[model samples]
Every structure is written in structure tokens, then in C-alpha cells.
Target: MAHDDSVLIESGLQVLKRYASRGETLSYDDLHRELGDPFKGADVAVQVGKLCDDITVQHSKATGLNLMISVLVRDSETGLPGEGFFQLAARLGRLPSTGDADAKRAFVLEQEHRVFMVFRPVKADTSGFAPNH
Candidate 1:
């Protein structure tokens, strides 16, 4: 039987949420491994984008916070393509968005095999969040 798109998306969400909760990065290889058959023959990027949208909506309704997921791909070795790194971020509803800055930082940290940091926004303070790495 063919798996439903919702099933695939839910599976992806579960993996993403787990990593997000731990402040860990998810690589393309990791996602492919965990997602298994559901991800087969699907446009992985589109699926991830959908997953991000779902996460944003669910997170917003549940916590009144904004959720962002970023994906980064780069060259692993001098002549080889690298895998993608996925990162998540949560921010207060009132703060001006820093856009992809935090995501980029998280990607860099993941590339270095360092700790992934989430810079959560604080009320009445906009000086910039701390680096968790």
C-alpha cells in the first residue's frame, strides 16, 4: 500500500521535534535513515518545507511562539558534496525577527560538530540571545 503524505509528514515531524527538543541538528542522511520508505521518491525539500509549515502552525497554536526550521547544505570535502543540516528555532511573538541568522549559526555549529544552540527571545530584552554552542 502507498503511504499517505500525512503519514510521511508526521513521521518527519516526529523526528524533527525530537531533535529540536534536544537542540540537536538533523542531517539529510539522518532524516533519510529515520524516515525510511515514507520519504522514498518524494521531493525531500518540499516535504521538509511542508514539515516546517506544520511545525510552525502547531507550535504557534500550542505555545504562542514562532517556529522556524532551516536547512543548510555545503561541500563536505574539497571535492565532495556534503549533507544538509536542519535546525530549529523558537521565538517570542513580539520580537522583531532576526530571520535566518540563528539558523545560519546553528548550521555552522553543526558543521563543526559543536553543540546546537537556540537563542530564544526574551520579553523586554532585545540585546540578542546567547550562543548555546
Candidate 2:
């Protein structure tokens, strides 16, 4: 079965861009409301996880809330550790404040910069819910 919902996919991408641009994070309720769905929590979770696996988005568990999530895009073509350098930093759930030996901060920063390039600037409150790219 082909499990793809263009609406959901675009929404997920926009959500990531929004979070990065605003420097504000999101929880499940935020996504649910944003998605405006008949979508269940598990459905959203599955979609999110699939996006992460597909290198289309990133997801993370928020520090305070187990159900809270942080998401971003992964397949962005911009931002890199120089030419030809690619890291599998897509669909990441969250960035740890510290205590990670994997240098996730640097990776996420790079990914964020790349994602910025993917989506150009728009109006502050405009819903980035379209796949104009």
C-alpha cells in the first residue's frame, strides 16, 4: 500500500519550517490543532515517524512532556559541513540541551540552516501549509 497523504506531508514540512523560523517549539496538541484533523494521535505519530524515516522530517521527544514532540525537515539540500558532506539528521525528534556524546547540537544547527534554505521567508503569521517548492 502506498501510504502517502500530500496534505499531511506538506503540513509536516510547514510545521518544521514554522518552528525553526519562530524558534518556538510544538507539542502534539499544537500539531493536532494545526493539522485540523480527524486524525488520531497515533495516526499523527505514525505520519511523523514515517516522515522522519523518509528523511522528509525530523521528530523529537520534548524535555518536559513525554507526549510533546519537536519536528523538522530532513531532505533539505542546503546547509552542509562543506561540499559533499551529508549527515543523516532528518526526522530528528528533539535536541538535547546537553549530555549527548553524538554532537546533536551541531548536526541540528546544520540541518536547521539547510531547512531555512529550502523554504524562503513568508509573512510572519501566514500558514506555511502549502508545497510551493
Candidate 3:
């Protein structure tokens, strides 16, 4: 049976959100595992690609922050095949000023695939959340 696009997208979002909330990055293998067995050989990668685009678009509409989720394919450091990892891009409220250098640095340092909501500009605020990227 063919899986509906909306269902697949929702499932993907839930998975992303779950990991994000925990301040963790999701690898392609991790995502596939969450998807369970393929139904009639459905392409999980294709579905995930679509889901990523949808999430980026949906989150971009929010105020204060322009959030984006990206799927990155990189060569494995172990010399294995290329692997994919998810990352979150966040741009705070407005353009950075001279005094905002520290904040921008902190933001970039904290910009991983983990949930953005839990992230704080100050390092002290991130004491509880350990990033797995």
C-alpha cells in the first residue's frame, strides 16, 4: 500500500521534533530505522527529502527566527560511504550589530540539528541540554 504524503511528512516532522527537543542530530540511518520496514519498497529517502523541504518552508514563516532544516550528505570520516545528517539553521531577530558579535558566535556554535527552542544565546542557559552533533 502506498503511504500518503501528508502522513509521511507528519511522521518525519514528529521524528525531527523529538530529536530536536532532546538536542540531538538525526542521521539517515536513524531516520530510516524510525520509519520501520518499507511498505512495498517505498523510498524513505525521497519521502524524507520532501519532508525536509516542507519543514524548512513551514518554519520560515515564524517571527523572530528564520528556521531551516537541512539534510547534509558528507563523506564518512571512517572512509565508508557518504552519510547524511540533519542540521538546523537559525537566524535571530535582526541583523547583527558590532555588539552582537558574541551573540552571533554563540548562535553559530549552538547551531546544530538539535531543537532551536531549547537553545539560548548565553551558554549558561544551555547547561542542561547536551548536543549530540
Candidate 4:
């Protein structure tokens, strides 16, 4: 399988950029809702994670070390990304395979701050998601 949902990837990137512009974080459910709730069944979260991971991979390639996808968390209270985020971060060598909780939280916070800095309206990438650079 190609595993390439380009439409969802494009749409999800827009949603992330929208939230990042406001220096805001969104729940996985929020992303799902914003993406037209295309996913169904128990794997919706997993599917969403895949979408975020895909966007992160492309965004990283385009912008270098920009894991801006940190804006998507399991929920706002926890304010932490799901295991999938950590997994991808590790796989990309951005973080250790099993970093301590504080370390992981710190990484996400830092990335979110960077996302806000780069994607905020004043400094937004007007070229749209993926940047094409």
C-alpha cells in the first residue's frame, strides 16, 4: 500500500498551521474534527497520528528540524503528544528512544514554541503547508 493520503495530509497541515498561528495547541479530536472527521472506528486516533507523522516528516524535510506537528496532542490537559509522536521523534533521531517524561514534555513544549514562532501570522509560511522549500 502506498499509505499516502495526500488530501488528508494537505488538509491536516492547514489545520496545524491555523492553530500554530495563534500559538495554540489542539487535541487529536480537534484535528479529526477539523479534517472533516474522515477517519472512523477505534483507529481514528491512530490514523490521525499517521497523518501528523506524515506532515511532520514532510515539514521537517522542507524546513529542517521543524517538528511543528507537536501542536497536536492527545488532549489539552495532558498537553502531551501521543506515543506515536515520541516514536517518530525517536526514529528521526530528534529524541532518544525512551526519553524520560520530563524530557519528552520539554521537547514537545520547545517544539510547540518553535512552531508558534515560525507559523504565527507575523512570521507565517505563506506558501502553505510543506513550505515547498
Taken over the whole model, the C-alpha lDDT of each candidate is 0.44, 0.43, 0.45, 0.77
Looking at model 3, residue 100 earns an lDDT score of 48
Candidate 4 has a TM-score of 0.82
Q: In candidate 4, what are the lDDT values of residues 4-70, reduced to their tens digit?
A: 7877777878888888878778898888898889988988878887788888887778677657575
Task: Provide the lowest-lDDT 10-residue window in model 1.
Answer: 78-87
- For candidate 4, the clash count comes to 0
Cα lDDT tens digits for candidate 3, 12-121? 66676677655555555565567673332466555444456555445445333454433221122422111122222323233233344455444433444334554423
Superposition-based RMSD of candidate 1 using all C-alpha atoms, in angstroms: 11.1
Instruction: Please give, for residues 18-63, the per-residue lDDT of candidate 1 as tens digits.
Output: 6754655555556656777344455764454444445444544655
lDDT of 3 at 113: 35
- lDDT of the structure predicted as candidate 3: 0.45
Model 4 misplacement above 4 A: 123-133
In model 1, residue pairs whose N, Cα or C atoms come closer than 3 Å (at least 3 residues apart or on different chains), thus clashing, are none
Task: Quote each prediction's TM-score.
Answer: 0.41, 0.42, 0.45, 0.82
Q: How far is candidate 2 from the true structure (C-alpha RMSD, Å)?
A: 13.4
Between prediction 1 and prediction 2, which has the larger lDDT?
1
Instruction: Report the number of the highest-TM-score candidate.
Output: 4
How much is 111 displaced in model 4, in angstroms? 0.5
